[model samples]
Target chain A: MNITLKQAEKIIAVAKEKSIEIDTKMNIAVVDAGANLVAFARMDGAWLGSLDISIKKAKTARYFDMNTGIIGELSQPGGPLFNIEHSNNGLITFPGGVPIKNAAGEIIGAIGVSGSSVENDHTVAEAGALAI
Target chain B: MNITLKQAEKIIAVAKEKSIEIDTKMNIAVVDAGANLVAFARMDGAWLGSLDISIKKAKTARYFDMNTGIIGELSQPGGPLFNIEHSNNGLITFPGGVPIKNAAGEIIGAIGVSGSSVENDHTVAEAGALAI
Candidate 1:
């Protein structure tokens, strides 16, 4: 199933709310199952450098069908997925990306958040993905 | 000026309306001046393979400050821009991508359309780019 624009907006809103609650700005990106951008928001005062990182994070989650934090751990040196961060042009194998799943437990899309500490980014991204 | 999510949604709406009027499914993509994806939509039944092409087209337009069709012509063998398409990780040097400009005529971003015939793609992309 495809991720509708309304759903994407809902995810962004949830993530933005969380970011504000934590007193941090964020660049949020939502991508469809095919890893194409569906919606994005760069909050006021968000770092410009994190703009693409948000998208890449979402893409990495979708591509691997798991959260980026898990991937990061797996891609550590001597790990089974070592050097995977260098794949797919470049992926953000960090904590800010989370897979979006439907009631059927099928992955539909992913949400990525950046512009804060990795832990905070992950928190915001988790809020968004869970909202879906 | 950066293309806000609201502005990108407006552009996509215009393009989708035009696509409906022409009875064609489309993959529409928008990118900021930095040639990074900001928003994208793949209408139901749009060719899946055109997904990446749509993003690439928008990047090509932003990179060259012109339409992809114009770039196609200039990049022809023996043309001054010969082999230019290969420069930017492979540009789509054809119709369907247009630069997005502000009131002062400064390009702010770009829009790209695919899934329909090249002519129809260009028409829809132009409609979106003109909306701003």
Candidate 2:
């Protein structure tokens, strides 16, 4: 099922709170099952560059149904997915992108975060995914 | 919201000061958090071609939350982000771009400068970014 705007907002709120709790600003984006952006938030003082990255991360996670970081590993120089980031307009195959699954374990959407380190980005995104 | 014209003008002011102090002609551009152009200035006698370069550099810095030079290094052949420059329309991965931050240390926008060496470009952009 596709994610609704209300659900997307909820995910963003949860993610934003987590970012604040961690004392970091973030650019967060949520995408529907179709890989389209549903909701986005660029926290005050967040990285401006992250606006594009956060959205791309969400789309990448939903497109592959896997963590963007995993894709990054697979896409290393000699890996099978090499050069994959060149596809899909431009995918961010780094940490901070996670798929959002429903209670039934079916992926319903995805979330992405950027601004802080990859570790923090992934942490914030994971927290948001659990919201859905 | 995003960076305002008045603030962007202030950034340009500092950047222009840097350019003058360094005795370099520069084309400077500032973009708001949305990556939209906010304010720009081309020093008298600056290279005509650098106007576009300055704008693109600012946008590139905001697109990935990293210095354009760093992106340059990462996009080198055999690097993890090889060929990335071809993805985002066109990105100047050399140098001369810096993210502007507000008092909260949030990236409110970015500044890009060209017309001189990459080193000067970066220095001027950094000076501008500190305006806000």
Alpha-carbon shift of residue A96 in model 2 (angstroms): 1.2
RMSD of each: 2.7, 4.3
Poorest 10 consecutive residues of model 1 chain A by lDDT? A36-45
Across A13-108, the per-residue lDDT of candidate 2 in tens digits comes to: 999999999999999999999999888999976866667778888998999999988888887777899878888888888788999988889999
TM-score of predicted chain A against the true chain A, for each candidate = 0.97, 0.98
Q: Provide the lowest-lDDT 10-residue window in model 2 chain A.
A: A44-53
lDDT of 1 by residue, B42-95 (tens): 776688788778989999999989999998998899998898877878899899
- Which stretches in model 2 have alpha-carbon errors above 4 Å? A4-6, B1-26, B32-35, B38-49, B60-93, B99-110, B124-132
lDDT tens digits by residue: candidate 1, A26-112:
989898888877767777558889988999999999998999999999989899999998888899998999999887888999999
If scored against the real structure, what TM-score would every candidate get?
A: 0.84, 0.73
In model 1, what is the error at residue A13, expressed in angstroms?
Answer: 4.3
On the 0 to 100 scale, the lDDT of residue B124 in model 1 is 98
Q: Per-prediction DockQ scores? A: 0.28, 0.30
lDDT, candidate 2, equals 0.86
Deviation in angstroms for A64 in model 1? 3.6
